[model samples]
Target chain A: MNNWKIFSNGLFKENPVFVLLLGMCPTLGVTTSAINGLGMGLATTFVLLLSNVTISLVSNLIPDKIRIPGYIVIIATVVTILEICMAAYLPALHEALGIFIPLIVVNCIVLGRAEAFAAKNTPLSSLLDGLGMGLGFTLGLALLGSTREILGSGKLFNATLYDENYGILVFVLAPGAFIALGYLIAIINKIKKSL
Target chain B: MEKRLESNFKNMVLVLCAITLFSSLSVASINALTAEKLNEVRLQNQLKAIRDVLPAFDNNPMEESDTLITPDGGTLVLFPASREGERVGTAVKSYSNNGYSGPIWLMIGFTPDGAVYNYTVLEHKETPGLGSKMSTWFARGNKGDITGQIPGSKGLRARKDGGEIDAITAATVSSRAFLDAVNRASGALSGNADAVSGATGLEASPGATPVEQPDATTGATPVEEPDASSGATRVDDPSRTDTSLPDTTHLSPARHE
Candidate 1:
């Protein structure tokens, strides 16, 4: 029962993107626009969820001497699959996401959950853990993206809010990206605490 | 006991192998499912770039390769405009080191008679706020007037330097780098000064520039062609030239304007 509780905690309480701050590289790099962040976050989630389950099923079998290396190989393999699928189908999103797609292999969120929760939990629980963590990261990115996009361009997903003539162009720039992300994270935490 | 231990190790290895195989299979399946759309996206990006630059082809733009140039020295991307096999126009991807952010990549277009059709910034790591606005800040900057005020292009200036082009307020380095990139790219496009001077095909309208004032100010004008014969040249080097371009080809005063 507690294992299930632990699995559900990843969705909010111990959220990887919001609380742990495990994967700042992708979190900052891809959240330029809401769509880009969402695409990248979802892609990472798929890789994480799949990798978590595979690692758990093989954890007992992997020799202690080779666990880290084996886990990496498994993670890398999953990322490659993701890379191929993006390149072959969603090339626009894939190209827009660029090298960050492959970098998902190193996202601490995926590996942290697998090691901390999935490896010890049953496969079903591990799957749930992956889904929850992925959703949390995705929401984080979307919020980061939304905040930047709305302020910088005055548009949400390309829909205009204010007149283009008066748009706050800075929000779209790199510095704006950093500033928006910092506040977004702060605000999300505030909302969480209030609840 | 030793035999039982040996069998367990074998089973463990088998499980790892099976997982690897299953993961790979799933990836392959996803790749197969999405390959077609990926190709479409790549094709769309190229078509879109050419369309933005060449305002002449306002109608149907064929998303097909007309001519492929395997330049020995530099990258060559040739998008030729042809109707019923008759030549219409051409756009070339060229580069310059004079750019502030190292080398700048630009796509210059020429009408069949070698007139300056239009140009686009392909990619660069110039400062974010200031120089990136070259497409926007000075869209109305007189073409032939080098002295026309831009924010960062002024002497020793970031936006902090208070050049006409506003530095990205915070990202000064990137702003200055972008100003330098446009200067180099513009010089190459004009084929007027020494940077990479070449035959200014008639479309260049040498004496007549957009909002033409005077050919008075001498910017870092270079010959447009960077000699593709020598492998040392980065001019049209295909390998060095791969980067994502914006959807529209028209050089605007927006981000990379």
Candidate 2:
């Protein structure tokens, strides 16, 4: 496939959250606010891109029997670097993301892409794929976060749009995550059908 | 067929080991590079917490901090607030193991006379909306405000326990923990400066040998004296009477007024 097809594929056709439904844990957990969603999305994207490129580069050297563990170590290392960098320079965001930041090591999308695509593809293609998938994940999280934040708390990105007390409190809680993600998937499905 | 299987297993083990070594080395180096910066951020956060609870002081509180061991075996770091050569107040980094979820950490500031200047929850995992209200719920004008109250003059328990302070709505456990942390901090500061300093050095370390006690003339040894009114026995371990006092005499006598 051409570069455009490789990159755009994850953006829509194989979207990690809405289409493939990977990384549901963070999608549902940190999308309490638009900023938190975006922060989580960006951090995951950083990990995905680096892991994809590195896995593709080293795929040849890794034996088939040990490929899963090899990929995991690489992804975990990348996540650790990201975690330390955030804690040192972006302390506020680091605090806001809390435990979810470290949990990125277990994110399925990073490993899934490494096993399914990056291992088989060239480094360039893998890089494109990571960028595309990461962007798609970010978009999905941002959407879910905005919906929940606006409905559950009457605020967007922590900026109060109205009296926050007037919000539908449940949307900001755990159940609200499932409800929001469910409706968002339905909307995406409808749009894809029309397209 | 046996040779092929042996070679395959060997390759797998070699690849895993090589990858692990590389990963470990990289993580170690990055940790080294960022460790200092991480500590700086942590110190800044702590200083900010101390400043939030205590009045303004000229000296850097982080530099003036000393670790004291609570009776329950937890470490309490006391940040002494001072201006010029005089001490203003003290903000104690205290924790209580009695929270609903787990330990609740608080930075509680006390004037030299023992009245609470103010307090702020440094960290907590209490239930949101209910237990987490212990953050601001214990401040002045709030339902559980204990600001300006002396911890030793009366028990700082929730009213349910027959104390003057109100508990957080539906969060009596968290309220109790918060008050307990404040009480621990205040108890540390109630004695003369030298005695508390000596106690900090002696008690802060778990396995270290207890040092000699300071001169009795300082009158700070009264901290370990059993109080008949409080109905608590304070058995002083003879060995931990001193490790040299951490100059708490910098505190201005004016604060006692």
Candidate 3:
């Protein structure tokens, strides 16, 4: 594949959230607000990028039978590093993300990319793939969060667009996450089909 | 495709060990680097919370704080603020174990006379949209506004529990927990040892004595007249004898299911 194609693949055609439907746990859990969605997305992106590059570089040294465990260790280490950095520099966002930050270690997207793409690819290609996929996931979460925020609280990124009293309260709750995700998937699928 | 390693038992064990070893070392280094910064951020947040709840004061409340042990074995920290040499108010770092999910921590500020001045949530593990509303549910002008209301005076129970304060919609448990914390803070401030212990369903200590009401005619300023009507018992410390305690009798039986 061309370099641009490899990078853009995850952005649209193979988008992690909308198309491939990977890492649904975090995609549904933390996207309560735009800022939260964005923060989680970026955190995942950092983990994904580092794990991909490290796995790609080390893939040749590790025996195939033990690759999964090796990949997980690498991903978890990256997540821990990210967590510490976030707690130190972005304490407010760190508090808001809470348990979700540690949960990123279990996010399937990071492992999926390492197994499917990075293990066989060059380090540079793996880097691009991780970046593209991470951005794609971020985009999906931010869109879903914005939709729910607007419908549920009459707010976008916490900026009030109308009276919150008039908002549909259900959209701010857990069930609302499912409903919003369903609609967003449908919309994205329709757009993809048209294209 | 890049060259691949053969899947052998020895290579599998060796590679896994190497990866885990490297991962642990990197994680340890990162943790060490960020530990100080994390502590600094936490201290800054606590200082800000104290500043937000209490009235203006020149004295460092943190330096002059007192830690009182509740009868239930919990500790409440009282940060008494002073303007010059006179006490202005106190910010009490209190907690309740009755939240819907887990414990909830709050910093509640009280005027010299015992009325709540302001409050800020220090920590909680409540539900996001529902119980988490405790952060703003009882702020000044909000629906559950408890500002200026003395906690022990009328008892800080949710309307669901037949109290005056309105509970957050769909979050009665959280509101009750919040009230419990506020009452505990008030109890700590007024030296009412039993008031703090009673909320947790614990009996007053054997050494506890019934608190005497401060004589209203003792030249105590009206703004500083501690509420004597709050059914508090056992002033623990002589230094805090003049402070007001909140009535927490109603909170004793109210438990989180």
TM-score of each: 0.64, 0.78, 0.86
Write model 2 residue lDDT over A62-142, tens digit each, in one string.
877778888999999999999999999999899878889889889999899999999889899999999999999999999
Name the candidate that leads on lDDT: 3
Candidate order, DockQ descending: 3, 1, 2
Model 3 lDDT per residue over B111-155, tens place: 999999999998999877778888998999999999999865444
What residue runs in model 2 are displaced by over 4 Å at the alpha carbon?
B1-7, B128-146, B155-172, B191-257
TM-score, predicted candidate 1 vs. hidden true structure: 0.64
Candidate 1 ranges with C-alpha deviation above 4 Å: A2-8, A163-178, B1-44, B55-73, B96-106, B116-257
Model 2 C-alpha lDDT per residue in residues B1-257, reported as the tens digit of each score:
01111328778888889999999999999999999999999988898888898888889878777886543367788889998868889998988776776788999998877889998887887754457668788898987889888876343766866678888765666777777777767656664232234534344333221222234314454443322123221112221232111112211222210
> Model 3: how far is B175 from its true place, Å?
1.1
* Winner by lDDT between candidate 2 and candidate 1: 2
Q: State the C-alpha lDDT per candidate.
A: 0.58, 0.77, 0.80
Backbone clash pairs for candidate 2 read B213-B241
Best model number under DockQ: 3
So what's the TM-score on candidate 3? 0.86
